[model samples]
Target: MDTSAAARASVCRLPRSVVTSVHTPVSPVGRHLVLMALCFPSASMCPKGCICQRDPHLHSLNVTCSQSRLKEIPPTLPVDAVLLRLDHNQIGAVPDQAFRGLRVVRELNLSYNAVETLGEGAFIGLEESLQVLDLSHNHITRVHRDVFARLKARVIVDDNPWHCDCALQQAISGMAHNHEAAARVLCRSSDLLDQDGRPFLAVEIDLCNLAKRTTDYAMLVTMFGWFAMVISYVVYYVRQNQEDARRHLEYLKSLPSKPKKPDEADDISTVV
Candidate 1:
């Protein structure tokens, strides 16, 4: 992209907002139309330097708007694009409907950006098509658990200063736990030197949750043990009472009827 051959960057001004500068040889109304066309549009509708290609592998589309000093995501993108690479930019925040239209994007590379926080529903519609999400080398500390809760992607979240706490532990809990996402999650605490080189998934995080589970299990076992002891004591007492009753019945049977012989002896004495 040289100076002479470069299409003159026109400032597309809208009613309230200012659209980005792109190579356009048309009126302001045409530039506004150009800006509007980028939203869920064709590859030919992208700005000057954006690279677009059809998905040769999956028969979709691929769009790349990388490192053009972009402070924002290019709004106009092909709807059926499967791969969108926007690496090495200054995209600070992701708005709510930024990626809502990209329903089939699989590999999204937003690495080396200034993304601090993603808005609510920022990735709402991407649960199905998103496969590989790269958010490495950014300024993100805490993220919503539902951001990657349903996506089955190889999420790259390395090189960010992560605070290992309960919120993060809950986010990566079930099928959402991407190993690479946890593999390089660096600790942020200065006093936490023991966990410096270790990944967040390997250390006390799993053990911490496991310890909680083990504690619950131990309580359950203790309750069962107490119930068993009470049952055993009741059974022992019942058997002992049964034995005592048997012994009393045997003593009563062994006590002879002594008076029966005494009656005949008395009658004989009276006759004499």
Candidate 2:
């Protein structure tokens, strides 16, 4: 029996229960703390490029990441964040379910970005809790019909280049019926030619412009048709007169020459 080797092995090894005690499983509270860290990022988590503070004017947790040129949403934003301002960034699109983690967000400000496409149901999760949504000064020309369906807030959509086409006509007209929603729809697209510069509410113009263009086209066609018809009639009348003169001359030629008098005939024969 190698007593030295046995003693060494016994010293190196411990009971299974003793080893388990040494390395215990993570407790529920520890897990909760880790989740808290992930969910509620404190001052350390906020970026130096942005601001996270409480405003007495808003009376909520305000996070302003405007003009930071950030291309994506801030990571690990506090779940209790109330007012989030992410304006003047280079963000191109709002992915679907992007703000689901912002459960208590009330006023979301995303103005002045290069947003081209807002994903379907992008802001659906914030439907009930959202209070004010500012999407002004972006490159977005048009929004999906249902993008603002669930949002009941002050929506600012100014300074965009709306196309004012057939598809936008119906939706803009429908927005008028809901005056609260309509008033909130501050569509300041240059497509809206209201000189007053107040939030343009002339969805009717978008609808009517199409009809107006169509009627103008029809009028132009009718004028052209009338001009062509008049020219054709004038040409026909002149040619008919020319044909009548030619026929009259031919008829006079077909008739026999007038007979000369006796003296005239005698003179003509003498000359010949």
Candidate 3:
């Protein structure tokens, strides 16, 4: 046989595994790339304007979007992210379930943002895994009573424009178990000037009871007004009915009496 035909026959005689290994040799760099692909399958899904890196030692994904000028939370965040830093942005509000998809996020830094409100379900999915929540230096004036009730994270809410009112008092009281977070709360403004610039927990006034009393007084006033309106309507109705009855009696009196019959008159004279 010719040399080319002999070489092809010799190669075909080799074991399949040996032939495959010989043809596809993997370099160290290639092996490292393959290992990375296996370890971090979702690394390519990093959000725009954010930096995502995998922590090999901890086996976690860290997504950093700080100072990105983000108006709102990214819609598509990797589900494997454990640490999310979104501070120094312009996120005005966190609507319901804003981080609902980030179930594994443990540390969330939302400090130095323009977040004015925290919706009730903003951290719905992170309830179980979230460990630290940094909401310091925001424009948050008030929050719903149950907003921070379900979270067990060490929340940092210092330097916020918190309005020290009954609603805030109720919200803080609900999170009393989170003592660290509750203690860090400070009142940037309040109805009473003395309460301003003081820690929320330090204020001794019973705001909730005062609010209850105010509500009670408002209810009493409203009830009294409604009662007065009902009495006036009843009196007006009775007077109107009486006037109609008097007019009817006057009409009857003005009617001429029927003349007595002649036979009736003659009967009366005979009897006399």
Candidate 4:
């Protein structure tokens, strides 16, 4: 807008108390017009490729700045705007207070981006009207356990590489039983192996707990247990079998040789 038109637009909305310097008009209407021009000289000029007018798409969704080459989130956003779409961008990390004054934001779509990590308590103090959250197709590895505790809406976090190690045990466990709150979640990890080829993510608790309990004292107890039970059983079994074989040999030697004596008695009777 031109200077004259810009001045008129800014001054037309101010209260009736402030005075003007551009024109010394005596009437109340003229006075308010000049006063607004003096206070805010540049309120009508919109950003490049963006308008300062109210948005008509979503009643609450006023401002939209998507599909841009923005590396970081813009600092100046409309506080009252509700729905925001920041898809298909190169935004790697979001500041905790990026949506500082946006208390009316309801649906947020941050999908198809390069968001690698989320800060803790990132969405701590959000608009109570927020209902749907979409963070799909990002480079996110793990969601902090207590990050979504304050959110009072449904969250969708699928198709991301989730690290299910000890560092991520709490997050995976939380999502497993989130049948009532969290929906359609998928967390993939190296430590999680399915025994029955099922798609369910499994935790190796036995391996985890055993490694944790392997102190010097515990190792000594486990080592001695195997030696005592295994060695004792084998030695006892071999000794019992040897004793039974010796008894059988002695019984066979005790038989007498009486056949040779009968043949000698018959020969002596014939000679007499």
TM for every model, in the order presented, reads: 0.55, 0.51, 0.76, 0.53
Segments of candidate 1 deviating more than 4 angstroms? 1-41, 55-58, 174-177, 190-197, 205-272
- Candidate 1 residues 76-120, lDDT tens each? 777788888989999888777688788888899999999988775
What does candidate 2's lDDT look like per residue over 1-272, in tens digits? Answer: 13442342244343444334322265645534433443334556565688887544454567889889898766667566788889889988887877877778988988889887787678867977887877777777666666776676666665665555444454454455356544444443444455233444545455456667877999999999999999999999999999999999999999999877999988989999
**Which numbered prediction scores highest in lDDT against the true structure?**
3
Best by TM-score: 3
For each of the candidates, the C-alpha root-mean-square deviation to the true structure, in angstroms, is 12.9, 13.0, 8.8, 15.4
Sorted by TM-score (best first), the order is 3, 1, 4, 2
lDDT (Cα atoms) of all candidates against the true structure:
0.71, 0.67, 0.83, 0.59
Which regions of candidate 4 fall more than 4 Å away from where they truly are?
Answer: 1-61, 166-169, 172-183, 194-272
Candidate structures ordered by lDDT, highest first: 3, 1, 2, 4
Q: Residue 145's C-alpha lDDT in candidate 4?
A: 64
Candidate 3 structure, TM-score to reference: 0.76
Candidate 2 at residue 170, lDDT?
A: 48
* lDDT digits (tens) for residues 1-272 of candidate 4: 23553455453444334323334434556555555444433323322333333443333434445677666666766565566677777889776866677688787777888888787656765737668767778888766765665666556666677654444454444554344433334446545455223222443464345445655558888889989889998988888888777777777777775576876898989888
Model 4 compared with the native: what TM-score? 0.53
- Which 10 consecutive residues of model 1 have the lowest summed lDDT? 4-13
